[model samples]
Target: MSNSAYRWMVAVPAFVVVAAFGVYLGTTHGAPTALDRSVMDTVTGLRTPTLTSVIKDVTVIFSPVAVTIWTALLAAVLVWRDRSLVRALPVVATVAAAGIVGEAIKLAVSRPRPPAIDQLGAVEATYSYPSGHVMGTTALVAAAVSVCAASVGARVAAGCLAAATVVVCAATRLYLGAHWVTDVLAAICVGVGVALVVPVVLAAVIGRLAPHLPAWVGVPAANAGSKA
Candidate 1:
């Protein structure tokens, strides 16, 4: 199959699943599902002072501020290395768009965090149908992997690393009771969708504009920075 076709195959189902799931959660009026409660129960049951402290530290590492700073640094490094703004646009755009999309869905769903009893790290005051932390990390890692993984073995390794990073971010949210199980899952879906769509769309736009632009932009073609 064509690359674009494969991307759509993966991205479309993700968006559709998240949309339906979001609607279901929205209508619940912040009530946790049986599965949500079950998972939270398990997570809360496993909590210890040491583990909680460790997870709280992990929370700080994946906080919105930290994620944004690291994402910006990554984009800057990529742009500097490639000497092409187009090369790093996908990572930056994917992460930014994921944050926006995740926030919007959170607001629309208006789901509350798990009960105070389950909250271990810090209290969050925002709607919580989707964990923005997971979304941001997921998008950042996925976009970076797409840009950097060129060989089959490299792509496989990068894919595993991206998955592990996303899982850790999601786990931090759950372990701290910052989000219900669905929230992190939905964030992953949304993040993946944004990561998948943004690069191709950006590449197409840059490809169309490449001829009109000056040579200094370093975008010579649609696939300049991206690997096939």
Candidate 2:
């Protein structure tokens, strides 16, 4: 299928799920659902000093500051590898968009974090719905997968690795009682959505405008000349 068609297929369902989940969380901000309580209970129950230490160590890697630093490095490497801003732009844009979208939704929803008594790890300062950690990491993983995977088999392998990373990221929040189940799940949806959709849209815009823009901006000189 065409890139446009594939993007549309992915974007529609992703945003829909994010919107629906956000609305649900917004409307029911008071208490955890049965499922939420059950999951939180199970996860928190498994918490121990060693386990918590390991999880916290892992979780810290996806913290906002860490994500920012690593994402910048990734973008730099991509630009260096491709020798073009065009390739790295999508990864940077997608990750940035994911962060902005995640924060916006959290403020709009204003969902509360899991109860303090339930928190077994580091308490968070932000609202809980649509976990930033999950969203950010998921976006990073998705961006990496999109750029690095070259073949169908490679894509599948990269996709599986990405999925595992996202799940682990989400689990950290749950294990810490920083967010409810819906928060991470919604984040995964939104993260993937933003990661996939932003690139496709950006690519199309860049494609159409590249020829007219300066070579340093996004269009390579030879590529621009070829188009001309």
Residue-level lDDT tens digits of model 2 in 83-175: 667556777788899999999988988888888888865566678878899999998888877777767787789889989988888888888
Q: For model 1, name the residue pairs that clash.
A: none
TM-score of each: 0.93, 0.90
The Cα local distance difference test for each model comes to: 0.81, 0.79
The TM-score between candidate 1 and the true structure equals 0.93
Error of 2 at 38 (Å): 0.8
**Model 2 misplaced stretches (Cα beyond 4 Å):** 216-228
Tell me the deviation in Å of residue 156 in model 1. Answer: 0.6
Which number leads on lDDT? 1
